[model samples]
Target: MVVERDELLDESCRGAAPLPQEADRVRLDLPRRDDLPDIMYLANNHRIAANLATMPHPFSLEDAKALVQKAEAAHGNSAFFAIRLRTTGRFIGVARYANVEEGMPVHVGYWLGEPFWGQGFATEAVHALVDHAFTHGTMDELTAACRVTNPASRRVLVKSGFQYRDQSMIRSLGAGGSVPIERYNLERAIWKSLRTWGRVAS
Candidate 1:
């Protein structure tokens, strides 16, 4: 089914680009210093860290600060948001659209605090970001990957409509080495179709 339309949709910019889209329960926005405590606490879990690349084990306050700083420092064609609940204003996770270097497809990535797992928050937040990337941003396609073992992350991607492409080895910084991964992609055309169908179905 099409995801429910958010009240934030009416508040969206009519211009070429819009962001910080919201749903009934959560909204996506850039990481902030005030989010440091929440980011540190929720992100310090072994399960969360184990599934992510570059998430420091025993994730520290400094690490949280650096992430916020980095998000603040990033200029254009890149975004990182701290996902928070509207009801409680609780910081629960992060979502990003970035190209770590030139000449790379803007891949999507995200992680949520364990408590928020199985609640559809990751998929909702990701749908917002994906819509922004395809509708507002100028890119042909977006790419994503999940460790072969991470069925959960893979499900998030599939739920967001990504198509599986291939398998390869990638570094899992938290795991401290290379591991198998399943690559996925969603092109502009595919996203357009889904969006159109969503409007029609709704």
Candidate 2:
């Protein structure tokens, strides 16, 4: 779904209002200092820490603060947000788009809390994030990467309309090692086509 830039920004500012309340889901408005504690807890877990490129294995509150600070300083080229459930109003994870090379492509990344896995929250939030990126950011193609071993994450990306493109041996900047990763990409035309089909079916 292609949300207008103005409407998407307004909804983002309003915490994604009008969204379903079943899980209290909403995208992050602006990262706050209070969000650090929960972010630290969820991100440091073994499962999450393993898949991401930037999350530390022994993540600390200090680390979380530094990350928030860095994100705060970053503008147009990158953006980050805390994902939360609107109903319970609990922060569940983090999502962002960064590493944007003008006239090339934009990279999308996200990680959810362990407890929130197996639910459709990640997919829903990713869909929203993808829409936000395409509508608001300067990019025609969106790309993401997942460790070859992470089937669950691959599923999430596929459901979000990202098609697997290739595999490469990448140095793990987060895990402090080398690992193989599967890259995925989605172009604007492809995204529009998929959405059109969905609307036709519904």
Against the true structure, whose lDDT is highest? 1
Q: Clashing pairs in model 1?
A: none
For every model shown, what is its TM-score relative to the native structure? Answer: 0.86, 0.80
lDDT of 1: 0.71
The per-prediction tally of clashing pairs is 0, 4
RMSD of each: 7.2, 6.8
Q: Pick the candidate with the highest TM-score.
A: 1
**Residue-wise C-alpha lDDT for candidate 1, range 1-202, written one tens digit per residue:** 1111111111112212345678668888767888888999998887776666677789999888877765554434556667888787788987777654568777777888988998888878888888877765778888887788888778778878788999987666666777788888888888888877772221
Residue 125 miss distance in model 1 (angstroms)? 0.7
Clashes of 2: 4
